[model samples]
Target chain A: MFYVPVSSSGGDTVNTGAAITPAQYVQHHLEHLTLNLRTFRVGDLQEAQGFWVLNLDTFLVSLILGIGLVVFLRFVAVRMREVPGGLQNFVEIMVGFVDKSISEVYHGKSKLLAPMSLIIFMWVFLMNAMDLLPVDLLWRILDLFGVTYFKNVPTADPNVTFAMSLAVFFLIIFYNIKIKKFHLAKEMLTVPFGGYLFPLNLVFRLIEECVKPLSLALRLFGNMFAGELVFILIALLPWWGQGLPGGIWAIFHILVITLQAFIFMMLTVVYLSMAHDTH
Target chain B: MGINATLIGQFITFAILVWFTMKYVWPPITQAMHDREKKIAAGLEAAERSKRELEMAERKAMSIIRDAKQQATHIIDEASRHSVLLVEEAKQQAKEEGARMIELAQHEISREVTQAKEVLKTQLATLVVAGAEKVIQRHLDASAHMALLDELVAEI
Candidate 1:
């Protein structure tokens, strides 16, 4: 569920031939600029060493983006006015929209969900917006710093997607345990089946509960990864020919990014709402 | 790519982000909006109150004007009636004064005639006495016959 196989290796132009093939290009783009926490050095286009290793690119991009957006939102929130203007107005509209969407799907009143959804929507959308930049842009820049491998889109990384989804999953479990208490145990044993099939019900409940986060993560990762992949593939085309299809995909991808962010938020709300509900 | 500490790192970042948002970002905008809504409602209510007060003041002013106009007309009628009564009283006093003066004049004229007639009669008596004296060719003492002459004058 969490593995992304390194499709190709030696992605740093070690080819005996002149120009790198398309496959190597895609592989190079997919590689993570990993930091081997044990070895105290960054990876050089190699496989991640062990569980202790961190994908510095994915972590930093997400952390920076997350903190940046949050900081900006908090900045705007600090300066909020009754008659909003500029960024304040935009932020209000966005926050109001998120609040409304959450209220619509999540009938329960939890303080955490609305803000969580807001950040999730905004942060994921920003991460997805990274796809719109030239596929080689950040790599070329980070490469100039002598960094070998980097994946710019954090959501394209399963670890980032799963990390966010698992956070929501933990919240779901926490709320289910907190609010439902003993009834949660009974329901998990008896749901979607009679008491005679309580074991089956438990298994089904486990699968069902696990699937929420699984689908949430995979859906976003799949869309963003495929999108990033296509852009990489489009970059494979001759420079003059790439514009038409690239432009089309980028335009269409605007919708995809927004919709993915929105869907991620909505599903989180729904899942948490389900967790909160007695059923 | 595989699961590693990046998931934990991202999880921490996501947690802190959501935490920061819940703490710092959410309340103020909504609060500002709520405060604005309350202010707008208050403004509308104040306008409504002022309009109502204005209507009432206008109505009161109109009523006061009506009352003052009626009072003014009432005073005008009273003033005219009082002046007419004063003129009639003055005319009546003038007529009575003229009649009194005429009556006073008649009394004075009669008194004067009576006094003149008595003086003539006395003068005639004195002349008659003087003629009688001359015809009789007697010279009586005029002073001695005073009583008889007075009586004769009186009779005349």
Candidate 2:
């Protein structure tokens, strides 16, 4: 193992480097705090190791943010006033934005859509917003607690993204079954290519159904992952030179983060609305 | 990074969050927003209703004043007509009384003149009879002229 040394202001020494090279730094930042659940190993870092592994960092971070969202919204709900101010006002604007988005897309009446969209937008946004925090600061803090691998943004992780998209996937199936009933099967077999080409129609219909969630998951994961990569790359530069590019990227990234969350939510509404529509 | 248990874990978390939000968070806030909207609408409707009522009341007051003015004019017209009728009746009574007084004065003068004429006639007859008796006694034989003097007295 190689190590780098740091000179303290008190003339003391601290070995701060877990990685000796720039490539290792990026790898280290990219790594997730994982657990191989099949073997029951908590801090497994080996790339080609386990069949059943859990990205504990992604799980924990997303869970905490999700809970934080629920708690904060609960607080706002409990103390909701006719004349809102502060956090309540901010939360209301977020809720209202999600409501407006849902109303725009899903014309069918479901009480679930608005709040579900709200959670997806805010939860994903909060997760993506974590990228703005200095990457090394959190790692340095975790280092003191003897934790080596961590990835802060859950949306960057494909598992988390698929998890949310799959939920929307289930909702799509549910609405199709609910609204179309027996006709859903008939439409799947006959509609686009016609009854004569049932096999081709089935293939195309399956592809269409699968594409909804796949695109949703991939779009969010790709954007956030790329953003995290850029931040890690910026972190590779010397401490003094990192500020300009980092600041500029962080500013531009605000739009990306918000836009990606919005896209994910909007797609969810569109998919569900399609499910509700008759052929 | 790849497929893992975190997928299921996140799905669970997502479910929990959605459930929690739907149960506790969504209903009350949405209810409050809708309630506020209904309140505003009701308030506006009430304001409109009151405004219409006020206009109707004002119109009613104006009409009432108009009716009162019309009634007052009618009463004034009736009173003036009654006063004119009373004046005409007084003038007619005065004219009738003047005519009656003139007729009574004419009747009294006619009665007085008739009475005076009858007294004058009786006095003239007596004087004529006395003058005839003196002339007869002086100029002729008394027995022969007696019969003619009696006849003339009878004629007178």
Scored by TM-score, the top model is 1
In model 2, what are the clashing residue pairs, if there are any?
none
Which candidate has the top score in DockQ?
Answer: 1
TM-score (all chains, Cα) for each model: 0.80, 0.77
With a 3 Å backbone cut-off (N, CA, C), the pairs that clash in candidate 1 are none
User: How accurate locally is residue B91 in candidate 2, as Cα lDDT from 0 to 100?
Assistant: 92
Alpha-carbon shift of residue A264 in model 1 (angstroms): 1.7
Candidate 1 DockQ vs. native? 0.60
lDDT of 2 at B36: 75
Tens-digit lDDT track of model 2 for B26-80: 8877777777779889999999999999999999999999999999999999999
Q: Give the per-residue lDDT digits (tens) of candidate 2, residues A1-279.
A: 334232221111223644367766676677787777776655545532554788888999999999999999998899888777898778878888888888887889888888899999999999999988887777677756666667888899999999999999999999999989999999999979899999999999999999989999999999999999999898888879999999999999999999999999999999999999988
**Where's the lowest-lDDT run of ten residues in candidate 2 chain B?**
B124-133
Query: Candidate 1 on B1-156: residue-level lDDT in tens?
Result: 878888888888899898988888877766776788799999999999999999999999999999999999999999999999999999999999989999999999999999999898878877978866774456466666666766876778
Measured by lDDT, the strongest candidate is: 1
lDDT of 2 at A268: 94
Measured over the true interface residues after superposition, the C-alpha RMSD of each candidate is 1.0, 1.1
